[model samples]
Target: MNTRKALYQFGYRRSPDQDRPTPAHHPVVVVGAGPVGLCTAIDLVQRGVPVILLDDADRIGEGSRGICYAKRTLEILDRLGVAQTCLSKGVTWKVGKVFQREELLYAFDLLPEDGHKMPAFINLQQYYLEHALVERAAQLPDLDIRWRNKATGLKPRNDGARLTVETPEGSYDLDADWVVAADGARSALRSMLGLSFTGEVFEDRFLIADVKMRGDFPTERWFWFDPPFHDGRSALLHKQPDDVWRIDLQLGPDADAKAEQAPERVLPRLRQMLGHDNFALEWVSVYTFQCRRLERFVHGRVVFVGDAAHQVSPFGARGANSGIQDAENLAWKLALVVNDAAPERLMETYEFERSAATDENIGHSTRSTDFIAPRSAQELRFRDAALALARHAPFAKRMVNSGRLSTPSTYETSLSTPDRDAWAGSARLGAPLPDAPMRDREGRPIWLLEALGGQETILYVSNGDPPPCSCRILTIGHDLIDENGFFEQRFDASPGSAYLVRPDQHLAARWRHPDSSMIERATRRLRGFDGGAA
Candidate 1:
């Protein structure tokens, strides 16, 4: 067996059909073995859900280039329990230098020292990320990852869904209880469902070059703004975990695909940016892309994820991270519904929450690009000036950094809701709570992230008598909570105010004392389980 086939069999374990008496179909059919597809499959298989993951590619390549693994993406991988393998070889960028003109204004402390949900950002090539995910998925006894298998006619059936699959071996008929169309922006599945991919295709083309070098570059992101190097368009310089530098050059509007991508043309751009005196070009590709997303991520039993669900400019690195988050959110909910833990309608929330997130992230990445790398000269100058001011001004810096690297855009219509007793005040409404530091019984500062334990919980900080509920109630201070209730000291919040947080680390409601039944109502609407457990 080839390295990939061997690793997959040993890792995710997708067995090839022997005699094939029209083999029985799986419960979940994931079409697209990209990062999103692979991640989703791994989650399902590990959870004991039978799944069949398919990809159009002969191998993981072309269609969706999986590059630039961010910090949030790493955290998601860590949650999968296989991040160490990737981190051991992926690039870690703790420091990044943001530039304006010729001056190096301020370096962004991208990674926080406090315990992270996962390791900081790692720069591993897409190939490696795919290999790792595929390996993990293969190890699952319930997963069947088929290579060189392209899904054709996908139609939902009465009790389940049927598909016309074309494999290198032969054509076959397959059936599944569920189908996920993660085929990407130009998803054949989405088109087959007559679902409209709504959004503007921003006319932008970028040329990406990956080169292996012997010298050492800083373990930080270097962004040059309208520098003398690559003409007017901005140049982003980053180091991959494999000691390869990924350099991007914004192609001009009139640039030709054929003429521009010639090795002669690409090597010159690299030479210009790297001082015309150094650097080597290992791999090059010219990519033309637009920002677009589907109006509805679901159409009956077939669901969409990753670029297939939505496509955004890779400015804030939110595109892939959001995709991974979608995979995680849908995986658990799908498992619950499949096992009858929750109603089938619960799966609808995936559309509600993820669609909302994709919309916001699209706007964020689009807006960041105008500043990160403007299209025109006038726009570039305006962005250059903005960065110059933000570098010196605290407020400006905070605003820019918060929007760029920071998450928590807000989830107003999520299916999961907080208990009314958990509700404290506005602090609990649609936002991530600000963190404060305090020592634990061990005398070391306690991290709120650790308190989360990767699940939904509540933190009630009240001055008056503490109310009762089930989900992780930690009453801080001497109010009615007790001496052990002093957890408020950890986040430096008010002594008597209680805040309700959700499983995804976003706040639900907050109040100083007994106020309203808003939290309880929301919780009921989400899980449908009325009582809170101790």
Candidate 2:
């Protein structure tokens, strides 16, 4: 009976100097090969933008870090052509339970609706995710993924940025019109630029351990507050693929992180929690919670994404999810800017939008941390009372904040054309379009997202003919069949309502009985051509 863990290897072949000469100038160079960097490069290359992706390491991540993938992230990955692989290799769950000292307090279902293409969340190891993304990236001819290519120096210019990379063979210099820094939290490029990363650092420490065992625990998130097994501390348990379980134990400020991570200390805790030592320890790490972000993500020609731009506590699963969204939000804008389809100011919107999202995630994560590990005795009393009352009262249950799960950020920017009509819909302007089940004209079952190509799409849900437009037109009830009535119920569609969707699938504007001039105005406003909102 073998219990050793198997690691994945993505062989790195040295690039031949004769065949891989440094280009005079590249359109884009991504400075990390993690999820965010790989996503950026894939999205750019799919849009006909050549990209050079550099990674300091040749192997996947060491552990199963950042295991939760939100629905919006799955949608973005679906666009990159690897969502199916992720879905197949991940554990899908939506229900979560909160307990107080062996007593169940409340339960929640993140996604209670049906007819959506993706679930609320999926738990897949970060290594598996990166492997799938790297495999997908390798299939693209426009993307050049260079392993073990470490960026040592960055020189920012008025026109572009020059990067000095160190490889196994030797050092080489490369120039790019734009540089994306998807590097980790301790980004060397970020340090070289001398930018300030400001935020709050909590004194609390947390122990994350991954154990492999044969258990019958259901695929759900279980959170405990002051559980009896751990003796007045918080704990979180989640099921992942390959029969691996992730257990997070909250350690007070006075506890030594290094000592707690030792096998002797960790095994006792596991035995107490599991009532036996049937599981094998796979990986363990100790970390302090922090909520921090750079002042600005765009540093002239060098742009930062993912952990390089922002970081938050692991409570809400926002770190990797937000970083991937940052890449999705920036890739299309960068492509448009490089191809001269939009103005340089378009890049500013990325900084503005993602910064706002980072702040939101930080705020929520901070609140969850405070609730989970209250510093003051008075705070703990209130948390206890809330958990006790949550068993019977619905209001108290809502007040219980274990982790306010991750969701897509809706941008409130000048890019979105203002709604011109009195509309009532759950999908608002500047928000990502809500997915629904539909059928294509050929009677094949499809999703609303499936019909939405990678461009500005116009969704008209009416009987009248849509206006003549340059973008793709999707007329519901005609071009697509509403088999489940989800469109009308979710979108609040009227007889002549029209929706303008951006390239990133966010709703830009909507109109009631809009003519060709009105549609054109909205398009122009979205592209930053029109001065006024449509």
Candidate 3:
């Protein structure tokens, strides 16, 4: 029987005697089946690491959770070979209008979505995005995805960890070299580790309604932040595929979760926000969200990922994407450690980098709420004036809507690696590999990432010069980067931009063009042969 009876049974019966999926002993155990956990499982299997992924969801994407998929998330999906499928099904919008009742207050467009390195932001239902990830996890031969299996107990062994799981068939114990917890905000495994999630719970309850609606309810996201008509309420409406639209209303501390769920109250609020009278309600949820971060993401044999590690407020769709990035970061590091390419200390950097990221996102999401509904009366008046000012000044539009989105952070400070060297300050330290066009010997355009094959490397920007034999060479420049842009247009010519890029796509080190002796020094750095070398 499915433990959660309300999850639309979908053939999961109440009786214990039923055919259940056989669970096998897996080398790596992932305790959650959300996007983050599934991504981690796929990363492991593709690299030849046998893994088992477990989740309590009867089928994937049933959870009416995360709705926004960012550019970084899409890049990860692209690496997993699911990006095209995702973009095909999802809607892409570049314009957003922030309103105050009837008058448009702030309007802005997302930065060039057809970015060199990534695709525009995508809007797919959380359910749909989850399905793609879970399906990919199901395809890997080295990976096992047990849908109804729930992690009941965790025990650390001498060399690895022992996972005790329960399913309808019965209970069994499995062993693994490592354990990853993507179980979510109320993470059981993290609790078992005695970790504390610390943050503040806001004083308002947010209601979400997914309904089939009529009327051209605006293709772009419409936000009514601190509208003068409503003293202390906020509303947002966004278009989904087909006739589906998501309408949200802010309910303050006085909101009764059960009482406010009534169709009477929900329908009216949705109508008001959507500016449509005819529509069928699909789902309605009234809940308050919290902003919290785990005290520590790593605890010896176990590691926390996604919402399990941090619960950033969902104001701007950072939570799910951040978790996926967490999985990507942790996956390769764990693989390297298990395969013995690097020391165990490398695993510690996972917590160091991702935790910093999660914390920053939490702060951004928190600030975003202030614009949704100002907490102070003075702030409310200030917003009204700011809107008036932005009306006359172009900078106001940019400033007010500056955080309707967020970008992935660059990784500048990592665990000391031998490759650590002086920075050129020309590149973003932890950003993804810059997407510059390249050429084959036959003179065809190829993506730089295509040449690297998503593995570790040093981008030797050769300016018509042959690089020494010690480093991986990518003869780039003269075509991809536009000189007028903020970033340096051409790489250094002498040794060129000799940058060591980690497998995770973060810059490890960069040096000036190489002399023969400098090439030797760069080579030693590439293989972790420096002062910080393990």
Candidate 4:
């Protein structure tokens, strides 16, 4: 017996492409309508690239799968025009507390700084996110979302790929210049392309239960290692919207996954942990961790994103957050490639940067899993010692990883030009630009990121003499005045200093003082017109 309600159910409609005599063609076809696919479609369409989004399911599922959206993820959502909705409807949090057997250890803040438009994190049901994305997609005329349209077969080609899509009415052939496989972990397109993930799968099992009850629990992440209720096991608590709470409990490797999810078994565990039986189970499931990813995200004209490309444990909230980042990173480059503005090799950078990010995420996730679910007695002993020391020693607290939460990945790509002079602050080469409050030319308040737009622009600190450059330039003190001094402190800006920002908001290059030739050369390299890194 489940206590869940359907949020939205979209009806399937026959696409006119199926009625055409020959195979209908599209610029880009996104093979899944999940968050990643929707994001990919939305970003591409906003960039003037028409995208057809296909999903096998016509409705958002009842399960609250991904509840935590990181600050970086929220920023990307804001760019796509849906972050405000998520913030308004979801629970916002930044602090997390870790415990050992009912003993208080320590709490940590995810975001201690201010002057940013988004919060550190937000907890909203995956269904609500999908609904918001769907609503956004509807507003864009170039984004065509096909419900109940499933991709069944694929034929790879040099110019593009051909997909055989199956619908309730019948199956039809569709050709696309490029295909994005956001179809998830069990990707049909991945199998069709003969791709396999390479990594480790932990044997330990964990149960997730979303309970509904009215309580005064503060909005924060709580992780307990070997709590009193579940002796020798771990438990996690998180507040969600609508008086719901997410609980995760480690069930060891040998526990019966099927039996653990039963209401009778789940209810008892909740009663012991909560000291009452006032909660109703909304959703329950058991899962094992698999830290894995494809060797290459790009395969000819077919690209994989989200679970189709990588998989990570949910402990760190890395799974969905990383996937959303994948969409953003790929969207801008893919649009440029589709528009013939950049070389085909530009896609290689997407493959390189995102794969590096996946490896970083996998490594962290693997370490977290090892610490959380120690396989041997020696490993468990080490974990116990670390937890004991974490109570007092700050160094030991850093060692204890309940799950290091998700953060934006800085790409050390060939596209980023090496600095000509020493630099300081968090505005390093190949990092996402830190947001700061500033005033636009009209004296209106705006964010540093909001003014960058979706193009490579030059961020120049002005001394009343701007550098001569052919690229778009946003001159500080002229276009945007940093009244709060945050932009100056965050970027270590000085008069005549300039920074090149990528379309995805990452730093591409910077210099203390640069001429027109220097700016043009770096722009060429970033555009993939030049060969080696500058």
Candidate 5:
């Protein structure tokens, strides 16, 4: 047995619902306690909504499933108060190099600028990430995480949903005002609701080997196309915590999955690639190319998140990163609806925004899949030519896709008010609000994201007092001082520039010398009350 499982496992215990005279009710019931489910439940509980998170297993599953957590995900974790745990134990990196054979095609830095709280990416084992989340969830009284509890059945309703849970002791029915199906790709709840996915499944496989070794390799992403050790196939290497290196080797569609995972076969490949025999295998698995998503993520009362809603190729680390974004996207919207602060139509925006995000992820994952594994001779020739040109030409280097790393999604939805005035900064109207360094009135340094918190805030960048508004007002020059001028440069903040930030830390709308009414209208538009025509 894996030591991580033994150390992190939670014993199955009977729930109060199992002994209740009637089906116990919860404000929200989250199926699957993976990263997504745990995050969703924790976010909801933090919002004052009681949540019951159920998982069939008691431990973080075997293998370091997803190791690359993007900076946006780290920001979400920061909001949830667990970013330090992940950062303390994860490998932080930003540089990545793509190579064709021994020749380096190009190298890219994910985050060229500084002053952000989090790095460009962190390579931590998924189990460690989940364990951190589970620990944080345990601190929230409203979040009840039930281990050894499998969601065997789901009945959707207009008001809520009824869940049939199977436990080690017995089966019991429970009621919830809303159900989150974060049960992974083969979601039992999704199946119970007779929902199916619609997308493509590429006919190629890859071997993921987590090997433990003390190497002098830098913490950088190194991807190779047709390397000498593994000719005619792609390979990738990433450093994880505990000196565990993740190595992925492309295996053709015809490769036997079972045989390839065997240590006898995997060891030889590693020996050739590393040119040494000082490594021990921690975990190994085989996976195929799959980029698919459900037609609709939201049903009547059941909402799907994470892999349950969409599955993308592991290349570019989009799988878990995108799923974490989905959980953040749903948590705030669902909280508002459940609290009656917003109408049910608010949840529909969750569907609209995240579905579009899924589409973008799928498109990128599929393109990366194609570029890594060309389907035909013509495609292969084009890819080879592109790689050859990438060695010298900058434009061709952009074409060399070794899985475009995951970035935050920009939602062009009704919740966001389109920009009326021209903006000169990276903070787009519908995109994530970029982070910068600032200081409070006391001159103590702070990060922009930490100051924003989780609220609909009006960021007025002026030395003068901000106009009164419905939402909280953060006066830039008064409340926060841009010590390095990064905030002003990144936001293009003139004296009277103002921005309306959403709860998820996204830019909803912005203006130049906006009045209280404009801020109110934008706030209403953000909350799904207004038509958002303006």
Candidate 6:
């Protein structure tokens, strides 16, 4: 027998006061210690809100789950102070190739436009991601991470919420002014609240295996439809750190998951795909795709985020990426509400914005699942014809869908003040501010996102006097100059144009000319005050 422990087996230290007290009150109590939960805790702490995070498991995730992190997710992680660690430990890839049998149908690059700080995507194991987040959370004094603490019961009150947590030694009660449910797809808190998810559960099953090997396979997303090695099925290959490759093999609905996972069956498939059996399997799992979400994420003082609120197929890497974005969207709003800077109604926008995002992800994931595994013969024939014509026709190539890919959703909410004048650039209200490289006041190159940090700010493109505002002012032509014209070209900014940005780095409003009253009105609107454009 092999006497070696698996990789990423973190030590579990017994938590303090397992049976000490009851009715411990906290400003915020977050359930689950996965990437989304930890990210939420870190963000809240960074925003000056104290939080207690609870998780049943002491260690990180077991497998290389959710390996693909999108660019928008990276930017959000950047604000949480872990983007550099992820970038250093991740495999960056932008190009993806699609194939039908032995013929390469099309190749595409996700980031055709350049000058951005982060890449289109990066592949890193989920365990590594959680490790980095835990490390980052440790640096903040406001975040209290409790391992082996499971939330078994939840009771929502008008003024606050009460939770029952079970520890190794015993169970205890906790009172929280606000509760954030990041528990996951099979959330105990969600269940305790009697909430149910609604969406489609796909019939097709997929086998995900993380195999350790060394080969000349390029660091790119390679997807195959009905390949010779894997006859009558689809496969996806992605490169991750530590010489591990993620292979997702689509098994028919009726395939025996247990038999397919056995080494006797999996090893031969690996040998056939790689032309060798030199690789070692690190982890393997069988799962069916699901597109499900709660009708609303916010309930009284309790708020749901990440997998606890929504789930989607892993096809577009939307599962984890969208969850991380949920944390980003909720963190700042929660902070404002807790600090009394914004009314509790501001938190309701979290439901409106993220529910729309969930719908968008579920819609795309459902389409991708249908395309990859068509239920009807007519759909299969259409897919095959599209794949065949993609090799020769550009239009057909556009129609070919391996996966639609994940992108940030633009919110069309009452919070985003519409533009009063004509704008030229792609940046719009309620969308994240586009990043561009420029020279800082110290004559050092910095990305716009790096300069913004996590504060509400004003971006002005002018050499003239800046408008008087309480927020930080980023003067483009004065403090920072557009070296390569990226800032001007990307934002479509003219002289004296100013943009009001939220603490989450989203554009709240923009003006062709800097107007102090208008900017102040927009800022007030964001803080839940009345009398502003909606």
The candidate maximizing lDDT is 4
**Better candidate by TM-score, 2 or 3:** 2
Provide TM-scores for the models. 0.80, 0.97, 0.86, 0.99, 0.98, 0.96
Q: Write model 2 residue lDDT over 1-534, tens digit each, in one string.
A: 113344655555665531456635799999999999999999999888999998988788588888999999999999999999999999999999998889888888999988889999999989899989999997999898888889999999988999888887777788899999999899999999998689999999989999999888899999998889998899999998999999999988888988898898999998899888999888888888999999999989899999999999999899999999999999999999999998887889899999999999999999898899888999888888888888898999987999899999999888887765676757878888999999998999988987885688899886666544656788888888888888987788877778889989999888777777788888877776675756
Candidate 5 lDDT over 1-534, as tens digits, reads 122334477999899899998899888999999999999998888887899999999877478889999999999999998999999999999999998899888899999987888999999999898989999998998888899999888888888999999999999999999999999999998889888999999999999999999998899999999999999999999999999999999999999989998878999999999999999898888999999999999998899999999999999999999999999999989999899988889989999999999999999999999999999999899898999898888899989889999999999988887778887868887888999999999999899999998887989887465455656888888999997988888888988888989999999988887778888888888888997565
Off by over 4 Å in 3: 1-25, 113-117, 226-232, 398-403, 415-426, 437-445, 469-471, 477-495, 515-534
TM-score of 3: 0.86
Scored against the true structure, residue 482 in model 3 reaches a CA lDDT of 27
Q: Decide which is better by lDDT, 5 or 6.
A: 5
Cα lDDT tens digits for candidate 1, 139-252: 687887776677788787756788877765666777888898888767888877778777766566778777666546687777766677766666677887555777777786
After superposing candidate 4 on the true structure, give the runs of residues whose Cα lies further than 4 Å from its correct spot: none
Candidate 2 — which pairs collide? Answer: none
Worst 10 residues of 6 by lDDT: 1-10
Model 4: per-residue lDDT, tens digit, 107-206?
9998899999889999999998999999999999999999999999999999999999999998999999999999999999999988999999999999
For model 5, the local distance difference test gives: 0.90
Give each model's whole-structure lDDT: 0.65, 0.88, 0.68, 0.92, 0.90, 0.88
Q: Write out the backbone clash pairs for model 5.
A: none
* lDDT, candidate 2, at 146: 87
Question: What's the C-alpha lDDT at position 308 in model 3?
Answer: 90
lDDT of 4 at 216: 78
| Cα-based lDDT at residue 361, candidate 3 | 88
Error at 369, model 4, angstroms: 0.4
Measured on C-alpha atoms, candidate 4 has an lDDT of 0.92
